[model samples]
Target: MRQDTLWVHREFRQLWAGQTVSQFGTYVGQTVLPLLAATSLGPRPSRWGS
Candidate 1:
């Protein structure tokens, strides 16, 4: 008897691989964008109103 599994299908494997890579890129962007924004901006003002 042949084993049945989603991994056995070529299209599912391709889709799974693509999704994995997309998710990783999303995580990396979410982490890095904020750090970049904070570093690029100037320090906070000492007082709200002078």
Candidate 2:
């Protein structure tokens, strides 16, 4: 079978599912961290340097 056809395999499906979940978590963390930092520290540039 060709490499493109390998997605039908069970292992590939599971790997794809896990990778999807992990990527989603990473995206959520990426979005949330900046918001958390903004809220917790306020929107001042001076506070960031020190």
Which segments of model 2 are wrong by more than 4 Å? 1-4, 36-50
Best model number under lDDT = 1
Clashing pairs in 2: none
Residue lDDT tens for model 1, 2-35 = 4598888889889999999999999879998888
**Overall lDDT per candidate, in order of appearance:** 0.87, 0.86
lDDT of 1 at 22: 99
